[model samples]
Target: MPFVVPRSPELPAATWGSYGMTTLAVVPLIWRRRAPVAVLAAIVLIGGVYKVALDGPGQPLPYAGLIAFYTVALQCAPRVRVAVGLATVAAVALSVGWKTGTARELLFTLFVSAAAYALGRLQYTRQAYTEAVEARAAELERANRIEAEQAAARERARIAREMHDILSHAVSIMIVQAEAGPVAVRRAPERAEAAFEAIAETGRDAMAQLRAMLGVLRTAEASPRSPQPGVAELRELLERVRASGPRVSYERTGSVRELPAALEATVHRVVQEALTNVVKHAGASAVDVRLEYGAESLTVTVTDDGRGPGGSSSGGHGLIGIRERAAAHGGTAQTGPGPDGRGYAVRVVLVTSPQEVGT
Candidate 1:
C-alpha cells in the first residue's frame, strides 16, 4: 500500500519507517484483550517515534493508536483510561503539528481519537450487561430445577407410604384367612367358603386402592380414575377384618363433622393398620375401634385385649406406618397399654384445619 490513497492530496508520501511503525503499532493488538495496557504503550511509543523522525503526520490518521486508546478505555482503570486517550489525542496532534494545520483539521483528528474511546466504553458496558443477564437466567434455571426435584421426591414418598398402608392391611387379612380357611373347611364348609369370599373381597379392595394411588404416575388419557374411600369406608374395612380376626366393635363419639379428604383417609388408614396388627399379633378375642370428633381435632383409638404385639419381630411396619400417617396430617400418635392396663392401645389425635390436613 505504498501508493495508497491519502486523506488529502497535499500530504507527503508515507515513508518505510512510517510503514514499520504502523505495523509494530498494530501487530501487538492481536493480544490487546490479554494485555491491553502493554499493547497500548507499545503503539503509543511507535507512533511517537514515527512522528519525530518523519516530515509530518501522514495523510491517513494513526488507526493503530486510536484502536489502542479504545481498548484501554474498555480494559484499563479510570485513571489509565484518561491518560491513554489523552496520549493518543496528543500523539495525533503532535504528528500533524498544530502550527502547520488549520484549527479544523486538528479538531477533527482529536475528535476521531475521542470517538474511539467512547465506542470502546460502549462495547465494554454492553458486554457487561449481556453477561449479567445470562448469569441471572442461569441462576433461575438452577433454582427451578432444585424445586422440581424436591416436589418429585415428596410425591414419591407419598406413593410409597400409601402402598405400604395398603399392602400391610390387605396382606394381613389374606394371611389370616388363608390359615383359617383350611381348618374351617374340615369343620364347617360354609365357614370356609365365607373366609375365601372375604379374602377375595380384600384383594379387590386393595387392587382398587393401589390403582387409584398409582394412577398419578400415568397419563390421564390412559388410566381410569379410582376414588379413594375415606371415612365412609370404615364399615367395609371392618367387614374385611371380621373373617380373619377377632370381632371389631366400632363406636363414634363427639359431634360428627365432615373432615377433610386427607384427614378422613389418614384416619381410615390408622384404623386399618391398627386392626391388622391385632389380627397378626394380638390374638385377641375382640378389639374396639373408636372415632371421636372434637371441635378442633379428630381422635381415633384402637385397643385390643390380646396377648401383645408379636409382629414387630416379624418385620412389620404397622405401628411405624400409623405414626407416619398421623404426623403427615399434623397429628400425634401414641402406642402403649390401654388406660385400664388390660390390652394394647393406639391413640391418634389429628388437627382439623385444612392446612393441617394438607388438602
Candidate 2:
C-alpha cells in the first residue's frame, strides 16, 4: 500500500527494507498464542527498528503489535503480564514522545492498548467460568446414575428373599402332609381327609402370594396390589404348620400394637422361615413361636425341641434371608441352640419406628 501511494515531502519514501520489516513484524503473530510475551517483544523490536533505521511509511494503527499484546494479556501469567505491560507502556511513551512530542497521541495509543487487554482478560474469565459449570453438571449426573443403580440392586435382593420364603415354607408343609396322608387313611379316614385338605390349602395360599408378587413385578400399574402377610397372619401360619404333625404354639408378650407394614411383614417372614427350618430339618415334636413387642422394638423368636443348630440347614438361603430382613430395619438375627441347649432357635430383633431405626 505504501508503494502504491506517494509519501509526504517531509517523510522518508517507501522502500523494500520498510516493507520487509513490516512483513516480519506481522509474521511472528502466528505463534502469539504459544509464546505470547515473546511474540509481543519481537513485534515491538521490529517496529522500533523500522521507526529508527528504515523510517517506514507509517500505519494508522499498529495492528500486529496490538494483537500480540492482547494475546499476552490473555495467555501469560499475572506476574509476566504485569512486567511486560509496564515495559510496553514505557516504550510506547518514549516512542510517541520522540516522534510527535504530543500527549494526545500517547494517551490515545495507551487507551486502545488498555481496551484490548481488558477484552482479552474478560475472554479468559468467561472461558474458566464455562469450564467450571460444565464440570459441576457432569459430576451431578454421575452421582444420580450411581444412586439409581444402587436402588435397583436393593430391589432385586428384596424380591429374591420373598421368593425363597414363600416357596420353602409352602413346600415343606405340603411334604409333611402328603407323607402323613397314607398313614392317616389306614387308621382314621377323617384325619386323612384333613391332611389332604391341608395340602390343597397350602398350595393355594402359596400360589396366591406368588401371583401377587409376579403381578407387581410384571406391571404394577395394571396389577391388583395385595397386602403382604403380617403379625396378624401368624396364627393361621401356625395352624398350617401344626396340621403337618409337630405341635406348634404362638405367644405374644409386651404392649401389643400395630407396627409399620414393612416391619410386620419382616416379622411374619422370619417366623415362617424358622418354622420351615424345624419342619424340614429338625425332627422336633413341639415348636414354639413368641413375639415380644417393646416401646420402640419388636422381637420374634422361634424355638423348637428338635435337633440342635446343626440339625436344620434351612437350605442355607433361608437363614441368610432372615438375617437380611432383620438388618433392613436396622435390626439383627441370631440362630443357635434353644433353652437348655435342647433344640435350635432363631431370634430376631427389629426396630418399629422409622425415626428410631439405626439410632
Quick one: best lDDT, which candidate?
A: 2
Error of 1 at 203 (Å): 1.6
289, model 2: CA deviation in Å? 1.4
Clashing pairs in 2: none
How many collisions per candidate?
0, 0
User: Which of the numbered candidates is closest to the native, going by highest TM-score?
Assistant: 2
In terms of lDDT, the poorest run of 10 residues in model 1 is 307-316
For candidate 2, lDDT tens digit of each residue in 162-257? 999999999999999999999999999999999999999999999999988988899937554578899899999999999999999889999999
**lDDT of the candidates, in the order given:** 0.79, 0.89
Residue pairs in clash, model 1: none
Model 1 has an lDDT value of 0.79
